[model samples]
Target chain A: MTVYSNCHVITFNYRQSGIMERIYLDNNATTIVDPAVRDTMEPFYCHMYGNPNSLHLFGIEVRPYLHQAMEQLYSGIGASDADDIIINSCATEGNNTVILGFYFNLLKDTRKKHIITTQLEHPCVRESCRFLERHGVKVTYLAPDRDGLITAKMVKDAITDQTALVSVMWANNETGIILPIEEISKVCKEQGVYLHSDAVQAIGKVKVDLQKVRVDFLTFSAHKFHGPKGVGGLYIRDGLNLPPLLHGGEQMGGHRAGTVNVAGTVAMGKAIELANASLDFENREVRRLRDKLEDALLKNADVLVVGKRELRTPNTLYVSIRGVEGESMIWDLNQNGIAASTGSACASESLEASPILTAIGADRELAHTGVRFSLSRFTTEKEIDITIEVANKAIERLRQLSTSY
Target chain B: MAKSDLIGGELWEQYSQRVADRMNNPRNFGELTESDAQKLGGRLVIADEGAESCGDTVRLFWIVDEKTNIIKKATFKSFGCGTAIAATDMMAEMCIGRTVDEAAKITNLEVEHALRDQEDVAAVPPQKMHCSVMAYEVIKRATSIYRNVDISTLAETDIVCECARVSLQTIEDAIRINDLKTVQEITDYTKAGAFCKSCIQPGGHEKRDIYIVDILARVRAEIERERNPHRTLSAEFAKLSVIKQFKAIESVLDEHIRPVLARDGGGIELEDIQPGENGIINVHIRYQGSCKGCAGNVAGTLSFVEQTLQKNLSENIRGVVV
Candidate 1:
């Protein structure tokens, strides 16, 4: 006889899989793990499951794979040296490491207690600054213009003698607005300040050459480009002595300390190799499909494509339909078996409007009405067409029912 | 082959087929015609409700038989997600054949129940559960309109936790009568804040009119005030540093002012603080969201902010619109 304590449980329908017709357009939230990446990771799970630090042949054999993954990732992102790459968890951990690293490193220095960042950063970076702000650090959040572009002049104007670091993203996760990192780097270099970019959304979609940009630090996650989850990389320029966030036995040259995620690195290596090979396709075919979807939706519905005037990632299309809300639009699209997202997935649950949308000077109603349809190499023309149709119908219905409309 | 089968199709298992069916062909859709309304004794009422978070709205139309005081027909137009449509459609269907008074008694839970094919399985996803609430509110407005009464005064009980159907009076009585201290105890007693947890704090999955923590704190403060009526609320708030003072004011605003502003798609942000005349602290704030450029900012809302701050924070503190 089975005895239970309480009967309170939330259960789902548990329908059979491989039976529904659904379109997944929310790629920025997380991409599906590539089959090639999965195949590359499968062998390590059983046969070659060895700790990279061990003295045996199993360890030595896996060590080469880890290095190869790092080499592939660094080369793909245009990092000059292999030692600069420090593998960690997702971009959240990488961002926290850089922020806390700088915050803790600058604790002794009385004069340099200031940090400059934009209002368009991911919550990981923005919340980290807020955490520092609560602990007596002065943070100046530079707001963006209407098009969601943060000028290098904005960064230059905000930087002062007391400023220790300037952290910004290469591309926004929500609006896909690309920042002028090279120009921002030039200003930071002139001001003698360290600059960090959360390049998670930019890694697979755009070309980021650190040699050309001259930024001190950059970060990217593996899963954004069809790799497995739980693995990311950070690049620190030479001679930057920032403290480590994690403390343990030597790992990644003591920059990030944890037992090696060998399988993750192997999958990431394969994923990045594929992503680099398909960069041209992403810039062309993926972009064309994204444009087609946006154009179709704009023609049929009254919606504003966010950051249309600025440089944006090829795979992202952020739109704000008049008289309808983002959550409802996404939900209606989901009913038609389409997957889209509103703002960042972490903050999606909360009813608060997207802070990024607000930061870009969107009116309150428009900020609450935006939906993001992020694509990947896996997204097809057929899916885009269906999404446009479903989205238009959903919007039309919602507008008819809406009090605002 | 179905189009989505090309992709793995594993995640679609979350929602039941009944939800898909209801979403595709919603029941009780569209509106009652003028002739149809005339046939029902010209007792027609139309009510529109909106969700601020997503800007989704629903317009409910009800045709009541004036002589019998019974609803002859009900229909709706929804500008929202599938859940809102299905919930509103089901609510309209539930309204038919019942008197306006009886139809007004139908709750959002009953609307949700009508949409679900199974008891355990939800008709809509948990996050979309609030969509059904729009349907429930529109019904109240429709009923009140048909009866020529105020909408706010219709809901006899003060509902606090919508998901659990717990009322404000029930929660207040639970705390005061049972001598409760913790939010968990209140949940165990009345099941308020048990389901969605939005009624418990500021940053929950859903927004609520009143929170359990606030209710508990107010009740506790009232009890304290009864014990010693001389002690002032937020007396030391003025003595804190500018940022700390901002933080305290921000909490008060988040707890009180922001919710009221956010309801109308408006918001407020603290811009600065400077010394005013004769030891008064002047807090400069900029209106955001719908509040920006609103004509009411000068005469109407500014007074609400000033009065609320003066009554709560301190007499010397003043709110200055920037």
Candidate 2:
């Protein structure tokens, strides 16, 4: 299958047919951009080609649209100032700049190289911590609450003068458990620690009020919120010293230098706006689908649903079908037209347990068998019914194959 | 799977359909439970030793309804991967309400050839086969977490799903209770019949799979193991028979896999490689500081060491360290 990326969102034209043909359910891995978001990106590719960083009328005229996009995003997430939003490649780079840069800057004043994070932070964060640890820097990985929630208390207890930063996620990707960011930010404030939250999964799913929560930094990708894959934004508090991850040019306030992903940034802004606009209504709708799918799998198939019961991103549902291989089940479902994920899209090819799954203490089998089906507002009832029918057949078949005993 | 001798067309068609009848009609899916298992449980599958005694007399599926903390729905189908016909036939007949979480811990290893235990009532498959059995066990543990909802309600709603098992609750539960960290454990729970079973070794499987250059690499492992037959195969070694002959290579390797590497400007530090159902071994070699990023590290060190050991050891080891 060929997947085309426009304005960063990957939209696919699937042409398989069958009652057995598959339907994709793993949107948590990525998403198809809203049609309207795509339309907004069209004009920029063909018409608005002037560089915002260039001189003369052409550059000056294009600059406001870019700033408008920035402003639209800030307003959407409840950030008070647009200046603090630094657009960059996805959250990975943002996470790297904030986390690594914070450490580099901290090293200037104190050799106290320490980072405290949740065990479930995204790989960008987890790996950075691992890399730093290799350099003799200390990092304390805070564990999440049972059911995968990261508690402020966990963060509070892990801090010391040695800690350069506290990094956590606003919502978990695998289980969709929303963390108590406001409370955790408050704790960080009280303790005088800088806090960085990888809000990638939580961006469009939950409301993030940078001003209200008062975190030192917030990192997220646009595609997760319906933007593009490579486009994302980072929220750094005003007057914060953020050294550039790339050093060249005056782009992104010198914090991140490179030719701006013009169409991508604009599209991401639109995606964020769309998400904020439809969040509440879509929440109830997709969550209804989530609950329905979860209930059906539980009732008919030997399946289990994962994620926080009440406080989680509305679309994600993680379940395991007992006595079946996830890979076989995935292949079987795909043969019939169901597209879903065993774990994060970034790491789907791997059979390893998602770090988030491990953080909440899921065992190896469950972690391996985990199938994440995330619903979007456009998902239909017929698709769900088909999923149930297909799931019932495929799960039973695969389970039969695994019955070695 | 037997060659059909019933040449009368109509009669054969009728017989085939008759057999398919047993597998028809939404057989052996599952549900959660309500009562807290006296000793911790959710849903289950309990298969009694058929004419054969496979250790799995029972496979339990479990999940808690977050709302009630009660097991939601619990059900089981007798597991028999091989006796596809007889196993399912017996499973449908035998399993119903056993709730020991361990009962569901059966793996594909135990199911080898389905009716392996049609006679022996208490025979456990090899300890190594447990990972296969444990794959289902992991799924059973994962399935137990679905007590949070009711199925009838979902069909009427709009949740579009795509996973064959579209549910991870049971697997998540297993992880929570078992404290499993690696993909091996999760894969075992799901019984995904590892495409490559090298990950779940007793030691570390940080890399996915290693690639040995040629038959020489295979020979080198034999030579290395033949050299040190006493070097313990990981606890998860699935087949001990072929693994048994590695002493010649083991001694050679302890005497060699590294000496050859050290001979170059580089050095080799051996990391544990797990042996799976197939005789494939997974290994890692660490190069000393200056030689770290050298391009031929894999070929020069890994290949040379592997080739020497396998070639010198004769039939001591199977596939490359990968």
What are the TM-scores, per candidate, against the unseen true structure? Answer: 0.78, 0.58
Which candidate leads in DockQ?
Answer: 1
Candidate 1 Cα errors over 4 Å, as ranges: A1-22, A344-347, A361-363, A392-405, B1-20, B39-41, B51-54, B116-129, B155-159, B162-165, B195-211, B221-322
Q: Which residue runs does candidate 2 get wrong by more than 4 Å?
A: A1-22, A344-350, A362-364, B1-203, B206-322
What CAPRI class is candidate 2? incorrect
Candidate 1 lDDT, B214-268, residue by residue in tens = 9999999888766654335445555778888888788878988999999999999
lDDT of 1 by residue, A1-405 (tens): 111111111121111222255677888989999898999999898999989989999888898888888788878878777338788888999899889888778844577999999999999999999998898899999999988889999999998889989999999998888999989999999999999999999888888888788888888899999998999888888878667888997988888889989899889888988998888999999999999998888895567888863388999988888777665677667656778887522124344568888787566666667889999999989888878777888888767665566
Per-residue C-alpha lDDT of model 2 across residues A238-351, encoded as one tens digit per residue: 778888888999988787889888888888888998998888866888888888888888895456777656887888887866665454455445546678766521123222
Which CAPRI level is candidate 1?
incorrect
lDDT of 1 at B93: 87
Candidate 1: interface RMSD equals: 9.5
RMSD of each: 15.9, 19.8
lDDT for predicted candidate 1 compared with the true structure: 0.79
